[model samples]
Target: MRCETIREALSARIDGEPEPVAAGSADRHLDACADCRSWYRRAESLQRTLTARPGPPVPDLTADILRRLPPDWPLSSVP
Candidate 1:
């Protein structure tokens, strides 16, 4: 993949949303592109930091959680 294409997909690649074939191409691009390598490092650092932190506390957690949940029954009205 070209550097521009790889750069465009870098965030999604870091988020683990990229297809395996595209990931291989992006990885190969990172090996040769210094700018992309630095970007990849920064993205990796951010992902790690975000995952390590405790998430925000929810107020009225029971009601809020229930409101956000998907309908459990197949025929249930979601909204």
Candidate 2:
């Protein structure tokens, strides 16, 4: 199987979606392909890193935004 096809399967599997290629075939390719193995490792690591973060807090700016608006601005028109 082409590396692209196997990579697609790997990505699908990582995302909990159906794999484009059979698991056994993709596994066999990954076993013999160093590059694909490396790609898969990086992809998994990235997913873990992204999902593990407690992201920075976002400050609520609704009041500040409203205050800056023109006094005569119609509230109904804002939307």
Candidate 3:
């Protein structure tokens, strides 16, 4: 498989979403390509870090703030 093809499949392999044939092809390419292997390791590391972190807390908006907003004000206008 070409480097680009393997790189495209790398994420699917990491996510366990690729079919066995594609995954095997990516694995074979990774074994032969040092750059792709590094990329795969980095992808795995990022996935692990993100999965380990806690999700962001929900914001607490008071009724007073809601009341102060114009009736026609769109939520998209906010930051």
TM-score for model 1? Answer: 0.57
TM-score of 2: 0.76
lDDT of 2 by residue, 1-79 (tens): 8999999999999999999878999999999999999999999999899999899999999999999999898999766
Task: Give the higher-TM-score candidate: 2 or 3.
Answer: 2
Ranking by lDDT: 2, 3, 1
lDDT of 3 by residue, 14-55 (tens): 787854455667777888899999988999999999989998
Candidate 1: what lDDT? Answer: 0.77
Worst-scoring 10-residue span by lDDT in model 1? 70-79
Worst 10 residues of 3 by lDDT: 18-27
- Stretches off by above 4 angstroms in model 3 are 19-21, 59-79
The 10-residue segment with the lowest total lDDT in model 2: 70-79
Q: Which wins on lDDT, candidate 1 or candidate 3?
A: 3
As for lDDT, the candidate ahead, 2 or 3, is 2
Steric collisions counted per model: 0, 0, 0
TM-score of each model, in listed order = 0.57, 0.76, 0.62
What would you estimate as the lDDT of candidate 2?
Answer: 0.95
Clashing pairs in model 3, backbone N/Cα/C closer than 3 A: none
